[model samples]
Target chain A: MAQKQINGTTIDVNDEGYMTNHSQWNKVIAATIAEEEGITLTPAHWRVLDFIDHDFQEKGVVPGMRRMNKVGGIPTKDLYELFPNGPIKKAAKISGYPKPASCV
Target chain B: MTGSQPISKVSIVVSRGSLEGIYPGLIMANGARMEGIEANLFFTFFGLYGVLKNYNDKIRVATVGNPAMRVPSAKGLPMPTLLGAIPGMSAIATWMMNKEMEKIDIPPIPEFLEMIHDAGAGIYACKATVDMFHLTKDDFIPQMDKVLTVGEFYEQSAGGQIIFT
Candidate 1:
């Protein structure tokens, strides 16, 4: 486990820098995390992040990319364009969700 | 950026038409997207079956000359390649593989493509293969991004890891 200080607030993160505590996630923290990934927060990005957060709270699992496109209504191409390197995991991390069990 | 090396992107080349060969590329490309890596799949040669509208769903496991085909329940017993040459053997193998995949929730080829596309993986067909086969743009699934030449694929995949599946 690791710790990251964002906006002067400390949060626990996994070794890969994904925030381990979902309660510590906020828009400010998400923005800081996105900045670390070289991304500036945008409405589209927030849309995916919000969807992931809400879905995780309800389902206890981050939605897969297929579900993200179908349910979140964000197109697959748009996700890649927004997240760049890795969409699902990056979105999960930004939303303060644990890494998906299926991702490696 | 967090003191960890990032996999910026990955390009997978699918050059086989058999169900077994094609799935590896599809699964890997989808996996890359899931991990937040940019993924591109280039279909060339017989691999175009994966993108062809009519054949994508009809791909079968290649049993003939495939020494690695195993009877799943037989537990490591290899199916003789000679027996695979019999009529309807390929279809049987394909059916068994599809059934096994369904047990684990893997979707059919068409749905799989839709899933991967929705996951933000780029699917491209080989321009030369399309031309050689007289395939038009409309011959591919709607999710296919483009028919790219080998050079164009290399250009787009610059600085990214390339995998031949």
Candidate 2:
């Protein structure tokens, strides 16, 4: 086994080069998450984050699909263009969806 | 609306007295969509006129009450209804708005409206006011969800904070 250094964290990599620690999944990496989803973090994305923060402040929970759909101000095509995979699913995941299973 | 959801949800109520007021709602709603936030706009009273296909063309913002407006020809001039009839008032207003928005890097109104619609923000007109004003579905913009009563608006606004600007 060869040890590799990533962000000051050492990980054992086998011939396959996969990190040895499954616990890494439990960590929150906002930048990595954004990169993984291909989000460029424009003021446009900040607008979404701000709205989500405001919604959470007033409502005490993240909105549901119905509300999300109603708030659907962003074009789905644009969203797909922005996120590629899916803005909603990726956003929900990054925001820590109320229930992960239902989120995806 | 999601309880504990981030205040990131953007809802705007259009109830301004001037053409200027109407544009903010339109711009913000459209901006919200572009940024990936959910946007909802409620057009009430005179604001409904902006969304009316026929009246939309006829709508004008009253400069009389706007402190920001300067009447070069005369001070304290009430926006003569006739001024609204000037052939280019709408175009002028659109131009001014587009210019100001460009200063802040915002897109133009038509593109903004399209983005807002494509993003999924539900646009609604006030049912009671629409009826009171003697307007019908035929008078409204093509994509309006429906004419909603205050009660209906409240139902929609239940989880989200309501903004009346």
Top-TM-score structure, candidate number: 1
Tens digits of per-residue lDDT for model 2 on A57-98?
Answer: 676655433344346454445554555433555554444333
Spell out the clash pairs found in candidate 1. Answer: A85-B36, A85-B37, A86-B36, A86-B37, A87-B36
TM-score of each: 0.74, 0.54
Q: How high is the lDDT of residue A52 in model 2?
A: 52
TM-score of 2: 0.54
Residue-level lDDT tens digits of model 1 in B22-64 = 9989888888776767889999999999999988999999988
Q: Write the per-residue lDDT of candidate 2 for residues B1-165, one digit (tens) a residue.
A: 557765556668997535676777876675555445666889898787667774564445454434444333334455554565577765665556556555544443434444456667789998878878898888877767788888888887665657787
